[model samples]
Target: MFMQNLPSEVLINEVSTRDGFQSEAVFVPTDKKIEMIDRLSLLGLNKIEVTSFVSPKAIPNLRDAEEVMNRITRNPKVTYVALVPNEKGAERALATKADEVNLVMSVSESHNLSNMRMTCAQSLAQFRRICGLMEGSDVRINASLATSFGCPFEGIIAPERVIDVIDQYLEIGIQSISIADTTGMASPRQVYELCSLVRRIYPSVDVTLHLHNTRGMGLTNALAGLSAGINQLDASLGGIGGCPYAPGATGNICTEDLVHMLESIGLNTNVDLMKLLEISRELPAMLEHETSGQVAKAGLRTETRPLSQNVIDLKNRNEKH
Candidate 1:
């Protein structure tokens, strides 16, 4: 039986424009990037993380961040956000007039050291600094806790650790925060427990789940998150994202596939599954990697139609039966 009386609507934030391309060895042209995001915005997605404001030296692929942000026709319905690593990055994001800035820090000490070259405390310090920088601007801040479920370096992060990180961000005054399975190490049970705890601890804060499909548990965890009362989800079109620091970590949950599941279950995401599939088809050629999304490979259930009698007879005759 379908789960009934659940929240009817969900908010899916598309992140392909930034997270999907950042790990690629090849650079996706700025024009193509702009085109992709523009198409996605029209697919009824209300939030799209467009680019990052890190030093060009750190992420050369997104060095054209400003141009991409300015060139794309901003949609009033969609909020365009940028990832900012530190105070300087937040400053850059503000300059681009980003609707919101997402800041992240790793929960594992080892992953934190390897990825950001900073300790957990130091990373939170950076987040504090970023909050200070955005003192009086229209730009909103979202604190994302990377590897909140399990880290590559440190397996199975404690729930207390996750709550502590959330508390720190909340104390710093970020009303909206995202918990990311950065390395795709989350399980369904983890999603249920963590999301439940998050809701209990900070009932008012807007909590979004950023799930990765690296371990093949993306959809299951998403269900668990929903069971735990999460309405906001982060996904990438074509499932094209990878963690730069976590080896063998694949892309995120595909946007089209996620929408398909939600719609089938009588839940609403306000996204067009067909249009999202069209966008997914463009990823392989653009990124030079075949996507792992099932929807991209096998079209939606209704997309398939039975063959005509004539065609079936022709096929039978060709078989020499």
Candidate 2:
């Protein structure tokens, strides 16, 4: 029997444009990026983290945030989200009419400094300021806790610390929260426990899982989160992303593969695998290197396995003999 607690359908929030592109060494042209976002909007992703309004020096790949936002065809069905590092970023995102504003901080103090060059408290202050800037607007606010499971600077994080960050987000009137396995140090048990703990403490808040595949456990951790009654998940097309500041951190979970995995198990992510694969197939050319995703190489779940050529050759030899 299907687990009653498991959500039958989950929302896949594609963060390729923001999270994925931020790490790319090459700056994808503004027009191409906008075109990609437009196509993604129509392809049934529930939300798209479209771009980050960070300083050009910080993430030069996404420097054309305003042009990309202004040019993309907006689909009412898809929520367009932008990452904001501070109140100024929030203001820029609002001016471009982003549907939601996302802010991130690390639970690990050392990680926070390395990644954002700020203490956890200072990051919270920035989030608060962004909240104030976005107040009275229809734009929703979401808080992301990077290094939720483990930190490279520090080892395993206590669950209480994650809760502490959420408490502040809740107090600031941000109901949507994402717990990220930034370094992919999360085990399934830890993920399950964290999701359950957060659910128990703040049942009403929406939780999304943003996980990296640094240790090749992103999908497993996602499953754990789902088993614990969480739904939304963040993914990047072709699994392209990594923290520039955090050493050893790597690309995110592959979008097509994640959807393929969940859907094969009777869960719904509301994403079209074929359409998503079309996007994934282009990543190698787009980035000038092959991607980290496996589905593109392994084919879809519904496809029949390719027959063994050696077996066919052996049968032909026997027939000739």
Candidate 3:
């Protein structure tokens, strides 16, 4: 019955260029960012978070947000998204012609303070102001509820707190929301409960699950979300992203791995797995470090290799016996 209720198709929103690159200490060159994004455009991603429009001093790695957004080759089938923190960011995102502007706030007060350097109420007010600024624009708004599952500083957040945040988001007229496990501390049962509650109460809003592999529960939590009727998910190439403000937090769920799992389970992500693997392979050389993605390190499940000499000899001996 659980399998029967699962959606046939899922929408994968790639966040490598924005979320993945933002956490790097060394700046990823703007041209390389553009090249990678252009390459990703051809792949069948439902959306690509191209960049974040924030103060350069805050996140210097993504300082070239404007130029990257302006230069990327747009794919009509893909919705280009930009993360915006305030009115200024909304202006910049609008100028870059982003298809959607993602607004972020934490359901946990401590996380909101640590991440955004403000209280929860302040962030909500800021979001309202940004929404007002975007009132006349054609671009859409998506509220990202950080620490929806759990918070590094404050510990487990209550489901009622999360629902209240969603209530405020709806009140502010933001219909799309992303429920993020900022530190990846959620259990599978917790994920199902919260996601089920959200789906049951607010049946109209578009919800996207943003998970991390901090404690290696990312994929399991995602499966739980799917069981709760969630079809939109956020993943990063090579699994490269985490909250800079959250201590001990790790990267997001690998895009290639997620696509591979979904496809293996007879669900559709509509992503080009081979092409995604090619891109994932390039991350190590490009970033000058090892990435956390598993499928990229190991071959796909259906892949095969010829028998080794030792295995061949063992087989012959066994046959003779």
User: Could you report the Cα RMSD, in angstroms, for every candidate shown?
Assistant: 3.0, 2.6, 1.8
Q: What does the lDDT come to for candidate 3? A: 0.92
49-106 per-residue lDDT for model 3 (tens digits): 9999999999999999999999999999999999998889999999989999999999
TM-score of every candidate relative to the true structure: 0.93, 0.93, 0.95
For residue 160, give model 1's deviation from the true position in Å.
0.9
Better of 2 and 3 by lDDT: 3
- Across residues 136-229, which tens digit of lDDT does each residue of candidate 1 receive? 9999998888999999878998899988877778778888999999888998889888998998888999999999998889988888898788
Please tell me which predicted candidate would have the highest TM-score against the true structure: 3
- The residue-level lDDT of candidate 1 at 211 comes to 96
lDDT of each: 0.87, 0.89, 0.92
Q: Number of clashing pairs, model 3? A: 0
Candidate 2 local lDDT, residue 118: 97
Per-residue lDDT tens digits for candidate 2, residues 133-184, read 8888999998899999999879999999999989988887889999999878
